[model samples]
Target: MESKTTKKVTRGRPVCEIKQAEQKAKLIFSAKQLLNIKSYSQITIRDIASEASINSAMIKYYFGGKENLFVELIQSIADEQFSQFEDLGEHKKPVYLFIRRFGEILQSHPGIVHLLSEEVLNKTTPLARAFMAAFPARVSKFLPPLIQQETGISDTKKAKLAAFQLITLLVSPYILKTLRQQAWQIDDTEIQGEAWAKDLYRHFIYGLKESNTNEVES
Candidate 1:
């Protein structure tokens, strides 16, 4: 019988590569955490490095600079948020469930809303402008398809309009938290939770269906 030879298979990533990847991830995570508590203008490379327990030079080496790091952070957040809506397309759940889950996500990660608001008000930097432009385009890409799927409304214009309305409803409470509490006696936590989600869903469905009926009649 001929001797059999077997090649050894590599099982996992190299230790150094794994460590390097982990270090990069730590930087990203630290940036996100700090952004949650402080605005972009206030956060520094040293602050992020301190938070991540890595050298500040590593941030410059890995991401080039603070602005680039922040832009990457915003991209990651937008990707995550848009991914949630993509799942809805596969399951085809009721629109109410989508609204409720969206509210829950916003409430859980209020930092994202705050960051978006800040970018809109302070559109002085290229990073801010890129983020502001990318976000709505991302939403428009995912939302109208989902609305069409749920409501069976084929009018692209109406679907887009409804999408804008739903987005406004979902985000307004968190964006205007202080004003909401003082003027409307409603807090962000309450507004972006299950109860408010359900109420908004009911009202939205009613309005959507009524509008569709009017469109068909006309």
Candidate 2:
């Protein structure tokens, strides 16, 4: 981890090395927790610092500001959730990946659901737009025609929509779990987000199987 203090590297020395994830994850985790209690706009640098027991300046040093920090943490969750899409080139079946990754997002900072209000989901913010834009472009590193192969949806628009729908279906249980918590009637543990995501994927893939495809030949 970089020092709590950023130092001038003597003459040509590189800027202080980036902090290790273990050292830094605490701050992220802390900020995530605080974000749950209040909207991102209501939460301040002081809140995050107090929660994490670190200096306010650390927020600036690590993330530059709250907006950036929220974006980064959300991006981090997306990374964990989409890792299989990144690895398997998006052409691979999503079911196997959805279960594991859905579990990952659940286990890892599922708390962020508190901050991710429906207002934000409905209204397009620059940070959210930037996140949405950058994410699938990388996935498109593997998506585009794989989408074509899968759904026979060749138009770029349709393919992207398919990707978004598949991702949404996989991740919706996190939000549902949050809703269940708000309802306060059921055990969150009993919700089974991962299994549900896998089962939905199973149904989706089974339904998407084409009549003229090789499976039909068999």
Candidate 3:
């Protein structure tokens, strides 16, 4: 008697699905590279597609549109950085670690800093509003506790303020990169690496400690 023959079915992603994922990733990467070179208003969907060497329709199909793609790109970057802070609350030196990591991120993606600065200054675009709302909420949530731990500022509001101040100090140099180079002769190499981060951390901590001492004296 001839036995029945059975066929096994594979239970993984189909070839088309894998191809789609690769295409999407390429689009995202190309968008990021273009963002570093051009402003949001200046970059077009065709530009991203061309940069990725894919069809423009793919971007629309994958991300809905240029604006949505931009939002997704920024969201991905933010998620990556925030994920690194998962253990921040439990860190022995949260402030130092945070500063060092932040510096590294900015150095790695100076274009993101520039893009955010432009969006913030404009304050009229949907991207700007989305970023303003989302970014600060995350900062307020994770950073205040870390700031409290580091500075002994028991009040949440004060701790948040301190956190904001520290962020400002870390971000200002990057945002003012052109001005620093043109006027002050400070180049990117001098202002962006581990050495720069160390100096910023020391200066900020010293100033904060001095302020706390003055408050106690008063």
TM of each candidate vs. truth: 0.83, 0.61, 0.85
lDDT of each: 0.78, 0.60, 0.79
Write model 1 residue lDDT over 88-163, tens digit each, in one string: 7776555776787677667666567767787655576878676776577777777777778888888999999998
- Greater lDDT among 1 and 2 belongs to 1
Query: Candidate 1 — number of clashing residue pairs?
Result: 0
Worst 10 residues of 3 by lDDT: 7-16
* Candidate 1 ranges with C-alpha deviation above 4 Å: 1-15, 92-94, 121-124
Cα RMSD of predicted structure 2: 7.8
Question: For residue 68, what is the lDDT in candidate 1?
Answer: 85
- Model 3 compared with the native: what TM-score? 0.85
lDDT of 3 at 90: 83
- Put the candidates in TM-score order, highest first: 3, 1, 2
In candidate 3, residue 32 scores what lDDT? 89
lDDT tens string, model 3, 1-218?
A: 99999866433222488788888788888988988878877889999999988878877778889988888888888887778888877878888888888788888876678677887666868777666655666876887788778777666776778889988887888888789899999888887667777788788777877777787889
